[model samples]
Target chain A: MTSLTPMVAELVDYYDDGEAARHFQFRLLDQQQWPPPEPGQFFMLSVPGAGEIPLTFTQLPDQNQHWWALVRRMGSVTSALFRLEPGAILGARGPFGRGWPRPGSDQTPVLLIAGGCGLAPLVSQAERLLEMNLGPVALIYGARSPEARVLGRERDRWQHKLALFEVIEQSPGQTARRTPLDALPDVLAHWGHEPGATFMCGPEAMMTALSQRLIERGIPPSSIWLSLERRMHCATGTCGHCYLSHRYVCQSGPTFGWPELELLMQQPVTTQTPPLLSC
Target chain B: MIHYRLAELAELTRHLGRTRQVWQRSGAKEWCQADASNPPPLEAGRSVQSAKGFFFAEQEHIFEFDGRYFRETLPKPAPFALIGVSSCDLVAIAYQDQFFASDPHYQARRQQALLVGLECTVPCEHGFCPTVDAGPAARPGTSDLVLHPVGNGWLLTVTSEQGRKSLQGLNLTTAPEAMKQQRQAQLADCERQFPDDQHIRDGVQALNAGTVNASTWQQMGVQCLSCSGCTSLCPTCSCYGVQDQSADQTITRRRFWDSCLYDGFQREASQHNPSDDAGARVYRFWYHKFSDDFRKDFGRYGCVGCGRCEATCPGVIGIHSVMKRISQHD
Candidate 1:
């Protein structure tokens, strides 16, 4: 059986330097022991200097020769991971946290709204949906800058099954960048009219605004699921670090339906327990 | 095998002699042995510290990170008798059995431990054993042997197979009827000195009943420096952090005690901190202690009311005092 601990793996490919586009295939010499990852799961990546961080799986092919993580270089771990060469090793563990809920069926349209690096994990969701022949799927990705947009090569592969929309944060020379908040009106105008299960991820502000707008526009909170970012040290439930109220985001969710967010938004912030160390 | 009269209990340390060594957790340094005639010999009412240190050590080496490979090496398990452990800690030990021995990683150390439980003859300053229903006496089966103070000697009640073997070399005889009466009398005195159990339980309930708001936290959060002192010293708090170290062509897994009070505790890789402020940090601590889910996970309240948090707080933010203050407003 494969260990749950994060192990060192060499960086096999690099897509972009500035953008968070890198393919990490763990140095899995023995393929049989590596269990296949579920579609929407993630792993906790730990870099030497940078602390341990969470990343989602992008691809799971027939041969379990290598596992891939599509990481956006936003913080220390990803940024450090980006600097490594093809042979550079980074630590990884999991295929953790529940990913996207299984598709409902062909009758229901699948709406995938990604803001910035939010597109990283959803690409896998989109890919798996297509692999499983689950349809009809549409993707509307919003980024602060066009340069920061992810998965340009995969975009063409998904063109047949996915109706792709890449909304630039600043459509160059424009005074202000058009954030998801600004594009909400247009996104809703296009995909909002359709009745479908909408999955969203990105910065909290964008997701919060989109979720709120979608709720107001009569989208039932039950049909929408949002991926949130909370502080998580032990992506395992051990450290009270990743906890939100009674739930562990690392365990209970990095994803929650619209109905759950309604409760979370209303819940007041509270202090947490102190660290456990017996002196 | 040397027995002492009830009044002569203060002289028990004379047997320990003038050159007994005090074990310190810090490095290999040892404190000078206490003069047997100077301070009163160690009594079992309340230990200067808790039994937590015996199992869940402080500043433990979970794993070491070196380049591309990480190796996890568990410390050799140490065997020692917890001479002054209270019933509350014994119950906590029962819970620890599930946490450590139930899992493979934790069981690595727990299986090596020898638990020596003792009956509490006196109450600590903040302890309310009867209220929580965990105190004042050992629950027959939790400990290896429970030592009770008798008229002129100690009454050792052997509970487990280990208990019987531990006393093999010692000369102990079945106590007479008079000794049993004295044991009962000592227990009664402790019970009399303890306040009504209902008040402690009610106080906790009321604290739970109060509204948890930013303002309520502000009252306590201001003094907190996000230091994890309280949880570090708590006997029952069991939150931990897992780390993976990869180096030397090997991967090792590690679990370290974690606290919610620290800023990084609830930090996400995305830099979106949930308990970002002192208010949220403080709220997380109390709610985890009083909430049903926390108790359900551990099978008991995390706080043993040891007051180590009270003693170590830089701002002197006592959890009991905070609960009482919050209850007063409720």
Candidate 2:
């Protein structure tokens, strides 16, 4: 809606998430108005001399007028973002793509699954659900190790609002090295699989595997959603960098139903068959 | 339709040159934009470089950050006119018009320019515009002015009010009805000259039917050097990347054309790439052009059939070659 032009933002707060991840709070400098970002939507963050990269919103704009981004030190722009201080200024565009589906009613069951730093968007959703007084929410998170678990300081606050499960692959004090898939059955069993909406974000393989398991367990593909990440430049549909068949992940989605993901997963290259053109 | 004698057309070019830049295809492969003191003769085939960059610039500053605030750097180009654009290129521009309808940067330049289309009476060496519905003759609504060359003069059909207004001071006579018949005859004759493009039809059908297997793309990808020549010369390939450069206390964020053939185009920060294989990237590139899914959105295949990709690709994996390979191998 805002196109691809970025607005300058000043870093207002900074938080370290173990070794590989960091979170920054940026306040918009340009007074231009934009619709508030939905959870799972993202922004293109630009650091001087580094370039632009798409980062999902970890937390939406709060009362202090700050938007949060969780950065994993992966490439030039993200690595540059990790080195910035609180007073630094950067450019941001978007709040692009469709976000996760909201609950239909207060009693709707919401299950959130996140792996590693994929927890960012889910955290935002969890916070919103809590504020809305949405019922029966649960979060199942998986990390490689105990130290790799992000948002460690906020777990106490989250536990009070909704059920939170942390599955670690390898840690000295942990009894099991279960992956998200291993932990999913028990989580679903606890919920009694009462036909509620499920959302997941993580590695593609993990999401694919988990979605299939859910489908096998009688969950409708449309009722399950996942957040997708792709190499994006212009968040608008014009740039072809983020295309998945006919869909531009930046515009048509960053979030999509499991049925759509299944369609995307089935075709490795081309788009689905199109209707014939009446010349 | 108006008729302009071959000698009198130059007068119109000279008149328009007084207030705005007049761009016309010059030499064998270039568009010369300046005062039309001596306008070049209209060419028969497509120009080597399509008129894409005039609307969607090759590189543009999207915004600038001066320490504390960001400012948009929308282009403010002077009004200009493109004369003698080929039918294939005109169709491509219209296709882009729909894609960038909401993009302010593209609209900024597009609103300041006028499009003049030239119908092809003869097929170029490698073009198959007819197969893609892009044409040997300009389609209605794609261009402001349509030019059809006759024996001693040109039949200029003013399709838009802007085109009619641009000819205000020039003295032109109404074209004879016989000129329209002659133009249609010429276009039909040119259409029949196009080589057997059954392979393209077959290839597109295979692509839609999901009959072209992965191994064929792998074989084709081996020949691809990833030089980006095809994408660069393509009339409809519109992918780009953005970057920020620091200068003193200010930073400039710019967007430049990017190609899907590159592996890094779809790679994530986690080092996980959906299209990690070279063959897969090659397949995705072609799929974007021939896929039916995009047709539903853009109302046509992305390829305009100008065949410039064939002329520019060093790897010989251009549209014709790839389509031929797919048809043959399958």
Candidate 3:
């Protein structure tokens, strides 16, 4: 792939999920063409002067050749993206990294878990599985509160397609408040953990804890997958910014099976936060 | 192998200077892009700056965009010849050649340049090339041409077709067997003179065995100001970051050398950084150099033992100091 060249894409649609996240849909310029991005794969999105940042595909390219992403305004680039108008032109490179693995057969069940904005990639995967008529699919999503839940408008449509369990950690009303992990045992019992695949996208602590719990529940490490986030620049393997020991997150993965991530999980968490920069 | 007097070698430099710029090690620790009119002095050891930037480039515009369309900014460097590069840097260039094998920008410059390597008969201060199998003498095929100082002249061996073509018009005679033997003796003497590097060996062992504690790395991190001096001077550091700049509605995306020592190197847009701590960053940097897992990919340690990091690091956290500290921690 000619990933070094930044192709221009025009913003066609814009929407907000909450106070923290914004979603944008774009159409690639006439000269640029890319295959529909797979779930969990990402692109380096940029606006002039704000610098480039990696964003996973929230929606694959549709019949009209439009793609979408969910971006949170936690840093400079996303802040610039949040401020852009519908007609603004943005620069992008790649539909990079290996995405989530496809199911082996239509009979194989699927389980998806997500937290906060981490639900973006899982939603993409859920859409694909439902389209393929994959049997017995389920999603366990957690958020801080009902107001903070992303994609709240799509809850009814999602509930119609699969077994979706939405939980809020802190809610004011009579609705039950629980973490995704708290509801996992019943979900595992219903699906019979040995015969299905599990996918997760969330905070490191959450993923680490969930993966270990899955393993303890007799799920194979190879059958569990996670999407990871790391600082990236080249989005190709040339730049070493995203190196996790021997693997470059931009190349080897934004998605990896639990077995592949076991060693990286062992590294101690450092509290030092980097200074704000667009890169 | 062809033999030429020192003056005759200077004459060849003058000839090449007529068409292409010629660079060579001059002064105590610098390289000068000289011409026939001013032939460079024949110095020993490595130059202050590695030959990395010549091919990989410190900063390059990969592409540019106006409001309308994107244009590729591939490099088109003029033909040039580098003279008298020592073996350590030559090996590093060869290593980078493998890393950037398919990269068009690197290939653009590499294809236009000719490499002339020099065999070191004496080790320079703070160098341990032999330990990494990088020299005392230049390795075969790492350079286009290799020059061995023998007697009062030089023994020039053409290692590639490009080397033979570069010297097509300059007639020279074949050297006798005794000259080759003299070159070997000099290299052997230089290798013997390198001070013992038991500390490096012990350090690598400790790193692999997981014997070096986190507290030691934390202490070393406190000393590092993250000036990026070590990575800038390191012959094997190839990390880079990309940025875009705009003026008058036109934007250019450029890639510049980035150091892993920087705090933001592994920080995500969500502000979650894997290598956030200075100690962890320091550990990752050295781990990349000494890790056995990397050896499986690159066929050797990333370090070529040029010791440029040791000479240039302001924090004194270069390979020598870091390794020495690790080795003595227990």
Tens digit of per-residue lDDT, candidate 1, span A88-199 = 7666666667777877673367778888667767777787677776556777778767677777777878887777777776666778666655666676577545646788
**TM-score of each candidate structure, all chains considered together:** 0.82, 0.94, 0.94
lDDT of candidate 3 over B206-257, digit per residue (tens): 8877788888888888888889988888888999988889887888889999
Error of 2 at A203 (Å): 0.3
Give the lDDT of residue B107 in candidate 3: 87
Report residue A52 deviation for candidate 2 (angstroms). Answer: 2.3
User: Candidate 2: where are CA atoms >4 Å away?
Assistant: A1-3, A173-177, A190-195, A268-279, B1-8
Give the Cα lDDT of each candidate. Answer: 0.62, 0.81, 0.81
Query: Model 1: per-residue lDDT, tens digit, B1-330?
Result: 212222332232333232222222111112123344553333455554556655665435455556656555566654434444677777766766655543434555555554545566777676766665566777555687666766555666667886565555444456666776776788878767875545446557764555544576667778788677777766666677665545675444556777877777756565466566776677678777666656778667756544456666786666666666556554
Positional deviation of residue A162's Cα in model 2 after best superposition, in angstroms: 2.7
Worst 10 residues of 1 chain B by lDDT: B22-31
Select the stronger candidate by TM-score from 1 and 2. 2
Cα lDDT tens digits for candidate 3, A162-242: 778776787787465577777678766764644378888887667877888988987788889999888888787888988
Per-residue lDDT of candidate 2, residues B19-45 (tens digit): 678998774468887457777777668
